[model samples]
Each structure stands twice: as C-alpha cells, then as structure tokens.
Target chain A: MPKQAPVPDELSKPFWDACNERRLVVQNCTACNRMQYPPEQTCSECGSEHNLEWREVSGRGKVNGYCVMHDSRIRLLQADQPFNIVVIELEEDPAIKFLSHLPGTPVDQVPVGASVLVDFQEVGPGQLIHEWRVVG
Target chain B: MAPTGWFPTTRNRSQEGLGVWEHRGKVAVVGIGNSPTARRWDETADTSVGAWAISAAQKALDEAGISRDEVDGVVTCPQGMGSPWAPNPIPEDFAKAYEPTDNPDDGLTGVSADWIVKNMGLKNVKATYHTPACISPALCAGAQVVGDGEASTVLVIRGTGNFSGRYGQYGAAAGDTASGPGQWTNPWGWQLIPQIAYGFDQYCRKYGSSHDRMAPFVLNQRKNGALFPEGYYYQHRPDDLKISVEEYLSARWICKPMNIYDCDMPIHTAGAFLLTTAERAVNMKQKPVYVLNHVSQRAKVRSSVETLDETEAFTDSIARKVYEGSGLTASELDICNPYDGFTLFTQYFLEGLQWHGVQRGEAHDFYAGDISVKGPHPFSSSGGNNGNGRTRWWNQLDCIQQLRGTAGERQVTLKAETALAGAFTPNMSDWMVYGTSPD
Candidate 1:
C-alpha cells in the first residue's frame, strides 16, 4: 500500500496547493492580524468568519521537540521504521506548529531548539506533503 | 440588601462566594464496581460490552445495597468498537448492519444508558446523560444529578470493547489519501505514541529529568497491579507480570522516551460507580466517600498536541480550582491517584498539584523516593491503568475504596481521610477529591 497523502478539503486546499508549488502558507487573520495553520474558516483570535487570508511564509522553523518511532502502526511506513517525528514551531508563528518526519536527520538525534526549513515530499500523485530539514 | 430594579442581587444561594463551589460535599460515592479485565472481548455468550456494563452496574448497586428499583439516574461514557480514531460509522448503517437483536444488551460495541437501563431492568431511571469523555466526568455528572435532586441514586458507567485487530489501527481508507487532521499527522506516521512521547521528551529536556528516574513509578504500578484481582495481568498471567527496575530500564522502546511499559495496556472492561446525596450516603452499606469537589478544564492548545508548557499551565489551573473549590490544601490530601493512562501524566499531576511539596520539575526526584502505599505520599496504589488494565476508572475506584477503608490488601497505611483522582491528560481533564466526611 502507498503511504497516506493529504486529501485536502475546500478549506485546506489552498494550504496544500501552496505546498505542491514548493511554498508554505499560513492563514493570516485580516481582522486580528494573527496567523493560524491547518486552515480554519474563521480567525481563531478574533472569531471573524471569512476574514482569513492566505499568506506565504519563509517556511523556516525551530525544532520544539521530537520522538523517534521504533515501530510503525501504519503498514506502508513499516519498511521505513525507526523514523523521527519532529514538532516544528514555524518561524511565522511559534503557536502554529507542524509535524515532520525530518527525513535527513538521524534517528533519536533531533536537536531540540535547532533551526529547520520546510521541504516537500510527493507521497502520492500530486500529493506534496511538507517535511522539515535541519538548517546549519 | 434588596435590589431596586427587577434584577435581584442577593448572591444566588449556590454562588454566594466568588470561586466557591457550592456543590462541595453535596454528593457522595457509595460504591464502585468493575467487570473482569480482559485482553480481548472474550467471545463468551454473556460477555458483550453491554453485558459487562450491566454486570458492573449490578455489582455497584449490590455493593451500595441499593435495589435496582432505587436507581433513578444513569450516566455513561459509551465506547464504540474498532479503533477509537476511526471515523464513527453512521448510526443508521451501524444499527442495520450490526445491531440485529431487539434486546438492547446483545451485540453491542458501545454501551449506552438506554441499553444499560433495559438490560438491568432499571425502571426508575428518570435522568439519563452521556458524557463523551471517560468515567471521571461521568461520575461528576452523576454527582450533579443526585445533588440537584434529578435522581436519588445514580449509576455512572464506562464500558470499553476491543475487536479482533491491532489496537488503534488506522481505519482502511477509500484511497491512499488521508483527510482531516490525519492529513497532517498520519502522512508522517505520527500516531498517539509519538505525539505523547514528544511531550515527555520536551518535559525531560525542559526539567532536566530522565527516563531512568521513571522506573520506580513503573515498578510501583506493576507491583500494585499484580495484587489487583480485577486487573488484566493479575487475572490472566499473575505470575509473569512482575517487573524489576532493570527490566523497565531495559524495556524496548515503542518510541524513544516511551517504552512499552510507559503505555497502559488496553483491555476490554467496564466500571460503574454508585452516587447519591451525602445525606442518603451516610446511611448506605459502605462508608460514604464524599465528593468534596471536582474541576473539569479544557485547555486551549495552539496545535494538535499540547506543548509541555501548555500541559503545566493546564495542570496548575486544575490544581488551583480543585483546592479553591474544596477549601483543601495539597498537604491535606491523604493519598492521590492521578491518571496514568500514559505514565508521564502521573508526573505532570504530581508536579501540577505540588502534592506533598513536590515542586516544579521535582516529581522525578519525588518518584525516586518511596512511593509505596506506606510512604508519606502514597500514589496510585490501586495499580491505576498502568498496573491494572486500561479500565480508566481504577483511579477513582481506588480513591473511593481507600476513603471507605475497603481497598483490601492495597489500602494505604495512612489514615486515608482524603484522596484525589483524575482521568486523561493534564490538559483537558477531569479531577475530583473524595473524603471520609462531608466537612
């Protein structure tokens, strides 16, 4: 079986679309001037509906924390066992976070608080998911 | 003084004092019951999820010495079959495909109050509620029902059923696409373990704690769980379930910072508690464990998983609420049974409550000390979910038992006048305090 890919709904489509184009975007609340992620219909800060605007970001972040999975419950990812799932706090908004396997980083060696940059991976046809890479 | 306008301002009787919980000592838990914990749903004729719920309810009623006809209220946290993360099957589709029998108790994965009422033949049930969380909140709701006179005797139950498959396996998708939050998490193989492990890792790094300091807690839970007759290990393989410090330290990692022992064993089980007004409870068969106060808080997290700081904030808020509501201090607690569904939660609760002067980041050091039932600060002697199977109610059950002097071999050596219990994570959780007297 192929690895699971993001099947974006209407609200998340733009965010995923930006990823496909090798860009990272976050939802900027026009009303509150606050940033959000994973797409919401309303501004979380101001609760203003239809006031969310997509804004492209530098895609830079820092490793907040991480865990190395020695086992895989997902069958397709079993072959790629012993991977790291790193929590990335986006440079755009520390509150807006993302999970990444941190592909190139060595297992059990995630440097917490180290800087990282977003990288996209095509797991399925036209499905570009965002991952992170350690920045020197 | 009377108000001049239509809005009278004579402090509503219940809200007389700001932040004062009027429901303190208004309700009491008289009895607790548990079905035999099992690794899987034993395919026995009388061992369905609904059946287990009914059995637990019956035991509670019996233990309370309250007749079935006296049960006037029911509250349940229903459990569905299959992976908990799987999308719930449409009710109509599920009923048509799976629920064939008209008997409410038969062929049930999730057990509801209506089914329990029908199965137990509870004729006087006037109030029914479903708390989508776990048994802690169900008990809280039950207490409210009794305290508010919605019912004189209320039974709160939580039942879990496991199907034949890997626990928490992702539901088979229609295609290779992951929708919803799974789109972000599942794609990277991020499941519950990694999510929690991340929190533990952050906690260790921030606090200078290490996994080695956690062995005492793990071993303590196993020791107590081995003695708990209703637990899965004790019921199934009592002889082989014991663990040593070396064994826990050497245990293989499911995820770094979270070995297999750090996680609670999921099992098919159901637990029920009988609650009533403190007035009525004083005359019941068992000694009344007064419901002093409870706080249910939902933390605001910016991300899918709560950060360590967020968890600490959540814990601190809960601790303050619990103390303010009950008018009790952490020093006054005789025993504590914090949720250990994930062992790390226990550390969070200890540090959060500062129980017995355990300061921030000092829980690991506290754990390194004596945490046995006979220790100054007794913790989770009932084996919790870590020692017991994941019944999710053992903490509360043990609290009630400890307060009532009925915990048998696992009872604390101290004069157990007061106890505390909680469920789920430090963030978004339910916590309650129980005492031997209403005061």
Candidate 2:
C-alpha cells in the first residue's frame, strides 16, 4: 500500500496548497504579530479571526527533538521501519512545531538543536506534504 | 477546618493559603472492586463489557455493604469498548440478543450511567454522569456530587475491552487519506509512540537522563505486578513476571528511548469504587479513605504534543493545587502512586509533585534508589498499569487499599497514612490525595 496523503479541509487547504507550490506558510495574527500553525480559524495568540493572514516562512527550523520508529502502527510504513521522526521547531516561531520523517536521514542520526530546512514530498499525485531535512 | 462552603479558587504560585477543598474530608471511598484482567476478549469465558462493569460495581457495593437501592448517583467512563483508534463494533445481533429487556444495557461497546442504573436495578439514583475522562476524574466527579449534597452515595466505574489484534494498529482499512491532525503526522507514519518518544528524547537531552537509568523502575514495577494477584501478569503470566535489569535493558525498542516495557499493556478489565459521605462511611463495612482533594488540568500544548517545559508546568500546577487544596504538603504523603500508564509519566508525576524533595529533572536519579514498597517513599507499589494492565484504576485502588491496611503483600512498610494517585498523562491528567483520617 502507498503512504497516506493528507486530506485537506477548509481550514487547512491553503496550507496544503502552499506546500504543493513548495512554500511553507503559517497563520500570522495581524493584531499580535505572532504566528500559528496547523491553521486555526482564529489566531491562537490574539484570538482575532478576521485579523489572521497566511504568511510564507523561511522554512528554516531547529531540531527540538526526534525519535526512531522501530515499530509502526500504520501498516503502510512498516517496510520503512526504524525510520526517524523529527520535531522541527520553526525558526519563525519556535512554538509552531512540525513532525517530519527527515527522509534520507539515517536512523538514530537526528541531531537535536541542529538547523533544518523545510522540503516537500509527494505522497500522492498532486498532493505534496512539507517535511524537514537537516542542514550541515 | 470547618466546611467553608466556599469554592476554592486557583491559587497563585506562592502556594500559601489552604484553599477550600469543598469535598475534602467530606467524601469517603468505602469500597473498591476490580475484575480479573484479561489480555483480550475471551470467547471461552463469554464475558461482555457490561457484565464486567456491573460485576465490578456489584463487588464494590457488596464490600461497602450498600444495597443497589441506596446508590443515589452513578458516574462512569462510557467509551472503553475498544481501542479508540480502531474500535471493533459489537455485532448487531449479539448486542440485541445480549440485552432483550426494555431499556437494555448496550453491554458491548460501552455502558452508560442510565444503563448501569437500569441493569443493576438501582432504585434511588438521582444523579448520573458520563465522562470521557479517565477513572481518576470519574471518581473525583462522583466525590464532588456526593460532597455537594446532590447524592449521599455514588458509584464510579470504568470498563476497558480489548479485541484480538496488535494494539493501536491503524490498519489499511483506515484508508490512505489522513484527516485533521493526522494529515500532518500520519503521512510520515508518525503516531502516538513516536509522539511520546519525542518528549522522552527532549527529557533525556535536557536532563541528561537515559533509558538505562529507567531499568530499575521498570523491573521494580514488574516485581510488584507479579506479587499483585489481581493484576494481569499475576493472573496470567506468572513466570514472565520475574523481569531482570538485563531483560529490561535488552527489551526491543517500541520507539527509541522507550522499550516495550515502558508502555502499559491494554487489557479487558473493569474497576469500580463506592463513595459516600464521611458521615455514612462511618457506618459502612470498610475503613473510609477520605478524599482529601483532587486536581484536573487541561494540557497546555500549542502543538501536536506538549513540550517538556509545558508538561513540567502542567504537573507542577496540579501538584501545587492538590497540596494547597488538601491543606497538606508533599512531605506528608506516605506513598506515591503517580500514573505509570507510561513509565515516563511516573517520572513526570513524581518530579512534578516534587515528592520527597525530588527536584526538577531528578526523577531518574530518584528512581536509582530504593523505591520499593519497603522504601522510604513507596512509589507505585501497585505496579500500576505498566506492571498490571491498562485499567487506569490500580494506582487509586492501591491508594485506598494502602490507607485501609488491606493491600496484603503490597502494603508499604511506612505509616502509609496518606497517598497521592493520578491517571492519564502529565499534560492532561487528574490526581487525588487519599488519607486515613478526615483531618
């Protein structure tokens, strides 16, 4: 079976669309001038729904933490067992974190606190999802 | 302290005043009942979730010497039918046939308060509550109801069912499109284990802790579980209970920094507690374990999983509130039963509470010492869910039993007058302080 693709909803469609274009965008509150991710209807910082706008980010982050998956509950990814799942703390806003497999990174080699750059992978046709890669 | 009748507000970090715990010393846990833990649905035994729940509740009521007619309130978690990720629905025919009577209890997927009242022929039930939270919160709610004079006696129960399959397997049947939060994680095959593994990873990096330091805690819990007759390991896998440090160290990694032993086993089980006013508990059969205070908090997670800092703050808030509300200090706790659903949670709870002066980021070091039932501070003597099964009841039950002097072989050698028990995770969790005396 193929890897699962992200099913975009009304709230997340713009984010996925931006990913398809190889851009990383987060919700920025005009009132508070803070960023939020996994796009919410209302700005998480200032709670201003109308004041929220999508802004492209540097796609640069640091490894907050990571794990090596020796076992997977999702059967589709079992063949890729012992993979690395890295938590990327966005440089734009450390609070806005993302989980990425850091594809091509060897298992148990996730460098905590190391810088990373966002990259997109197509899990399904026309469906690209954002991931991260460690920067030298 | 008289009944102030004033609701205690959240105290500032100063932790000075004895906040009015409205239910403190008012509600008493008089009896506890647990069903035999099973690995999965036993076709041979032919038990239903409803049957287990009712049986556990009945055992509790019997121990309390309280008739079904006397129960005035029922509080329960109604969604323990199967794994939340992937549930095995009860067959329509079996469900219908199982309960042929009018207002029949579902007894398969879940059991509601009304169904329990009806199924048990409870006569005087005046209040009913169904909470999706864990067992600790359910009991806390029941105690609050009784303390508020809505009901004099209440029954708090939880039943968990397991179907035969690998736990938490998001089968291909779940489809190829990850929705909502999964859209971000599932596409990368990042699931619950890895989510927690991230937290542990952060803990190890920040605090200089390692899984090797966690071996003694795991081995201790397994030893305790082996001795606990009511637990799953004691009942089913007696020979496997003798876990060693070598075995624990060599345990296959479910996720890095977390061995298979770090996770609690999901099982088929039910547990119930009977609570009444302290006034009524005096006339009951067992010694009353006073409900000193309880704290429930929402997780402060701005992302998919809570950061180590967020979890620490969350648990610290709970600990401060519990101590202030109960008018007790962490030093006064005779036993500690932090939730060991995941072994890391135990560390979070202990360090969060600062029990016995265990400083921040020092729980791993604290576990390096003697933490057995005979230790200075008996930690998770009931073996918790890690040693037992994922019933989420052992910690509280052990608290009651320890305070009541009925823990048998698992009893702490110390005074064991007061204990702290909690459930779920450090981020989103509930905790209660139990005492031998009301004051």
State the lDDT of candidate 2 residue by residue for B1-25, as single tens digits.
Answer: 1111211223112232448586789
Off by over 4 Å in 1: B1-18, B81-107, B172-175
Candidate 1: tens digits of C-alpha lDDT, residues A1-136: 2468888899899988998999998889888888887677777778898888999999999998888888767766766778888899989789888988887788888888999999988888887878889989
Give the lowest summed-lDDT range of ten residues in model 1 chain B: B1-10
Q: TM-score for all predictions?
A: 0.91, 0.93
lDDT of 1 by residue, B1-439 (tens): 1111111112111121336456778899887888876777655536666667778888988888989998988888765534552333334433443333333333355567766776677788888876655787777677766777878899988888775677665564323667887786777777767877888888888888888889989888888888677788888877545888888899889888889889887788788899998888888888888988766766667665678888888888778877877788988888788889889767888887888899889988888888888676677878888888787788898888888887878888888998888887775677778888888
Best by lDDT: 2
Per-residue error (Å), model 2, residue A87: 0.6
Q: What value does the lDDT take at residue B386 in candidate 1?
A: 87
Candidate 2 positional error at A99, Å? 1.2
C-alpha root-mean-square deviation, each candidate: 5.9, 4.4
